[model samples]
Target: MIPKYNLVLCTLLALALAACQTPWVRDAQPRAGDAAPAVAEHPTATPEPETKTTPPTPAAPEARIEPAPPPDLWTRLRAGFTLPTRLDDRRVQLHLQWFKRHPHYLSRVVERAEPYLPWILDRIEQAGVPTEIALLPIVESGFNPFAYSHGRAAGLWQFIPATGRRFGLEQNWWYDGRRDWVAATDAALAYLQANHARFDGDWLLSLAAYNAGEGNVLKAQRRNRARNRATDFWSLDLPRETEKYVPKLLALREVFTHPADYGLELPPLDPDQRLELVETGGQLDLALAAELAGLPLETLYRLNPGFNRWATPPDGPHRLVLPHGASARFSQALAELPEAQRVQWQRHRVAAGDTLIGLASQYHTTVALLQEVNQLRDHRIRQGDHLLIPTARESLERYSLSAGQRKLALQNRKRAGNRQVHVVRAGDSFWDLARRYKVGVRELAGWNSMAPTDTLRVGQKLVVWTQTPAAANPNIALQRVRYRVRQGDSLARISQRFKVSIRDLEQWNDLDRRRYLQPGQVLTLYVDVTRQAGNG
Candidate 1:
């Protein structure tokens, strides 16, 4: 287990991939355990009777182990193997060549998957599916539940929004069931099963259908049938990606089934690195959950990757995963905590000009979370809308970063070593600073060792990192000049003329999306007279 520490606020201390769960204040964090005097059940032992004639001594009671393996994930996975080992196909061999060259990627993915592999493989076994299906995540998302594709598929299984909803995976602002391993795995298996049956029990065809929807597969199959061609997966014309998807899985299966053949070494699984599921009585903040579990909040977030917010969802599945070591203590402490105190909240009333993004910044939370907690269907909220915002909690050590993310962070630091300085003005805020620099609010906060919700005084200087220096950046020469509305005036035209984003124009002038512009009406415009090449 990773050692826990009472951490301090610093640039390096951050929950990677987590935007809102950043540390607030964590000085002298409380420990999970407290001792009390034990009460005596019995004062003394009774004398034994000498009635039995030479009664044999009873054997020591054998330690009872709950019916499970020794918590070895690798052994468990291998034992549940149900997939065929035959692999002489041309496509599979080609994929093996690529994988052999990039063995490090495989090792890193396997390591990241350690926290959930045992549970996932167990479920696949109970479903009577081949253990090879367990490696499907490697092909889809590298076992990262937060993985999102440019194609709009998300989660480990990479379910698209429509497909996820069809499988009963909720996609509300609060939670994305697509990222829930328990839900997504089940849904993926069900879809695969349906596809298998539809394709007459052909596993290869089923995998192809999983990549490209079953409808698409059916359409291709129909074309093959019309032409009286062979109806097998390889014979039919399919999407290019689907054609390789099955081969990728087969290649992974070959390596896992015979690692030594490819000269790759698989590490022994840690028995203590086991996941434990706990029933949260209700929605609970993960900061408190980590404290009670005697572990880092990042570990909790990793175990419960499906939880998008700092806390569990308000509706159902009031459960979260913890390290097996800390599960008992966390569950016990949670039971004793008051329901109202599970998450510290502040009531807010929306003003006439209040925006969700602005309000979220003021509250040190995300706009999506605000929408989720209030169950708002859209961004539109009327004035005086009562909002309950979760207050930030102090944190200790940051969640461990994935190897890839760590490398990227290092690369960014090296690139951002030379930065531009931005001074806070009369109308400056965290949101404005990020927008003006084209960086996220969290990135700005981390750069300065401050939280997004921290207050900034006028004349406070912030170090802003850019690809180019401030003197060379054309945007730095932006001048706030007034432009009069003409007969053919439009926000898009004005934005193009000034080389500014339409969103920035709307924000700067506070104009509604469909508001009309009258001729001769004056508008504020920030333009750059000095144009520079290769500037963002």
Candidate 2:
């Protein structure tokens, strides 16, 4: 039978053409008087139908778009589909066997990962990286942001510390970007893009470089050239990790796209969900902001994973991106807070020539309170010191006292709740546990009904604290002072030196009512000094 396309084309050619423009047309002519000569119009063409009824043999149906031949099993096993320049050659077959063998592991990974796909994909696209790379986290981390590899690579991308830093990821006490979806996604994409360019735009080589490094890929290229062979990632010897990286990525790509073909079921994704970033200048306390914005602390923490401390940097200009809807309320709440209140918590990184005294004076705080909040044991601080200043309406000293008293008031804060028990590990100490739970050492002991002398042991399962409603920290007691009198100092001189009256010195230090100065003599004096005394 004639093909439908041929019939449609033939029918089109036989239609009337007078209504449509042709290659040539006559110009208008005007005749004198009332007579005008007219040109003859052409007859419309019609398709001719033959009387014969014999059917024409059908041409072989156009070949279906065949899948590219699987690369030589060994080669395809080595090289797989890449994000750029290629889309069809995938390595799904190899992982199917492994997936079959480890069904439960895959299931658990899927279970844990079902929620994050949309977020991850959004970040991946934000960096202009292929969305397919999003599947890689499933293989590398089971989509756990906090996942770490034995090689010390971390985060969702499993970047090593050096690489993470190179990508602008901050590694500090409070945060690891390997777990920061936003920061890590940005850094990882930048690294991948750089590697892609460096390796001549071969994505397979770039993948190998990402798992290893560009330097290794360069060395391998040299080796292949030395041997005069095709210098590609598959032709070069690579590390074990790099060797599996490409295959695993391609296998993941297949699982994500044709999940059921591999007997896998992926959770549904909200393809349009994405986060919006709001730039918040200056360091802001995330917890405080969360409270002000009516956001849950954990939710904000999850969204702004880059903040290593409870607060953002005190230095000018910091940005926090809210998940879609949270920014408006956060911005409004932030604006409502007194400027002075925000300044009070502003963080300052000690620059050269900065001192605790200078900072205290500038912020209208006492040096002692600054040191207390910052836990500075020395009066001298070097450059690049980070200090949390209390610059708000309340002085650090007052805040400290209030916090301490507040904790004491929370004596019944902890009601019966599900308890979380943890065993101490090696290098674990009381101080560590106290800080971890944001409790004081004494309070921790009290909560567990333990004596101060109770020792912690590795592997000892002990209740750390009863779950309690969050309250301010307890007040720290200042140590009392007992002064010893020195030689060659008269009672009057001693009183002047201690900023106390001679009469009070005599009464408190128990000086003789009628004592004369003497060399090598010692007298007792009470040292009830305030922060002002140090300044004086």
Which candidate number has the best TM-score? 1
Look at candidate 1 and tell me the lDDT of residue 11. Answer: 21
Give the per-residue Cα lDDT of candidate 1 at 388: 85
Q: What does candidate 2 score on TM? A: 0.49
CA lDDT of every candidate: 0.72, 0.58
Kindly report which residue stretches of model 1 are placed more than 4 angstroms away from their true locations once superposed.
1-86, 347-357, 364-388, 395-536
Q: Per-residue lDDT of 71-183 in model 1, one digit per residue for the tens?
A: 45666666766554446778888889888888888888988787778778878888787778899999999998877664567789999888999989987645688888878
- Identify the leading candidate in terms of lDDT: 1
Off by over 4 Å in 2: 1-94, 103-129, 172-179, 271-273, 340-536
In terms of lDDT, model 2 sits at: 0.58
**C-alpha RMSD values across all candidates:** 21.7, 17.3
> Which 10-residue span in candidate 1 carries the lowest summed lDDT?
395-404
